[model samples]
Target: MSEFKQLYKPLLDGANWQQPDQLGIEGTEIGHWLLEQDSLSRRFQRHCEAFTVSLIEQVKISHAALTNDERALIGDEDCLLRKVVLQGDGQPWVFARTLIPISTLTGQERDLEQLGEMPLGFRVFTDRSGRRDALVVADVGTDTQPLWARRSRLWINEKPLLVAELFLAQAPIYGKEKQC
Candidate 1:
């Protein structure tokens, strides 16, 4: 197996990219470089920015659900959910939502220090037809992990009965002997 394939096999096999507590030296370096120059990074950022704006607009429209007093109390509810969208070139776009509580607003702000950062992981999915699809990095968080409890309904129309979810956790290390 090639180096790239070896590095990403676990993630591809798992079908869920999970962030690890700590990345290896080489992994960290690669992550940094990719975030700066990869085509995937560029596409991901574009889509994520657009998705976030759209989500915010949606939230604003739904603000009517809250009473006037409640709206005034919350002031800007945008702080509650931070949306990130990613779309790799020639790849399907991915939307990720990070939920932040009002209590830790300051911490959340600090976490955005590396708002557009990418982690040391990549994912590839194969459809029933045997075609491979690349999964883009949609978001990263520090104040709190994103809630993946609710399956996103966005995939319903595209793939009937399909439910998409986000999972934030540690990724398994690829042992040297098991490379690829």
Candidate 2:
């Protein structure tokens, strides 16, 4: 198991599995502010909040082993495991891991369009038997247009780990003529 896994295991086993809303640092402004607070409970709450934001913004998933359907599903929403590593004075701290679900797109075309604009890396593969699969990596400026046009599924990864998947389904192409 990786260091993060080891650090996070205890939190996962605990009962208070709430998502964080922020990330607390040791000496920065947010950190100082949180430290000055009188209560340890409030301090911990602030720390979790800061950690949450960092997880969403910095944590990345590499998608090298996912089906096309999985890729499509991730493209439609932000569902994935959010993680963060914090360096302390004596040791490194791994925050709890939370599986966040992405919102699904309602219409086929609309969702496809949305996927096309994602700034994450995407890849498509086909097996000899004609099975299709795709992988997605969460990074800055990764494109999703090719996936949409080809109707490929999506997966995301980080540190050689699969974090999320997207699935696509067929839907009727609606036109202006159907309106009464």
Candidate 3:
């Protein structure tokens, strides 16, 4: 396992994922956020005066060490794992984790490894070659304080990157409801 995985085992281990529609959240506001096809960072900025991406850690993990779900999506290749928290008005709103295969970092794409304090969603949206796959939702927090998350495969220059973003309790995407 990567250091990030070891450090965040509770969040990443044994996660349960389901289609948003199957979970009956497709018509809700949080559902809208979960199913957004555009840049989540842009949508977040529209709801908050200030938005920031705070890096937690970035590490490289061997394919043999990745979680089963991660391995299934990213295939059997060594990858770079990046963890960050997206904040709105100084309050943490989302925890994002990205997996980029080492082979994907070629030419201009190597810039992805050096995006300190920059949101991955912004980069994906700005890049014309970026394409988003279908999303899956999960409850990663707890019963009392559910942290809803969305995960998807992003293709940039025909390379695959996995992105998972868990909505924090203070996220405005939760709106007036406590659960999606």
lDDT of each: 0.27, 0.26, 0.82
Q: Model 1, 35-128: lDDT tens per residue? A: 2222232333443323111221112124344334234433334334334333333232333343322332343233322334231112101122
Which pairs clash (backbone N, Cα, C closer than 3 Å) in model 1?
Answer: 48-85
Clashes of 3: 0
Superposed model 1: Cα runs more than 4 Å off: 1-79, 107-109, 113-180
Between candidates 2 and 3, the TM-score winner: 3
What digit string (tens of lDDT, one per residue) describes model 2 on residues 43-62? Answer: 33333323111232333234
Structural similarity to truth (TM-score) of each candidate: 0.24, 0.23, 0.89
Clashing pairs in 3: none
Flag regions of model 3 displaced more than 4 Å.
Answer: 1-9, 176-180
The deviation in Å at residue 16 for candidate 1 is: 18
TM-score of 1: 0.24
Decide which is better by lDDT, 1 or 2: 1
Maximum-lDDT candidate:
3
Q: What is the lDDT of residue 76 in candidate 1?
A: 30
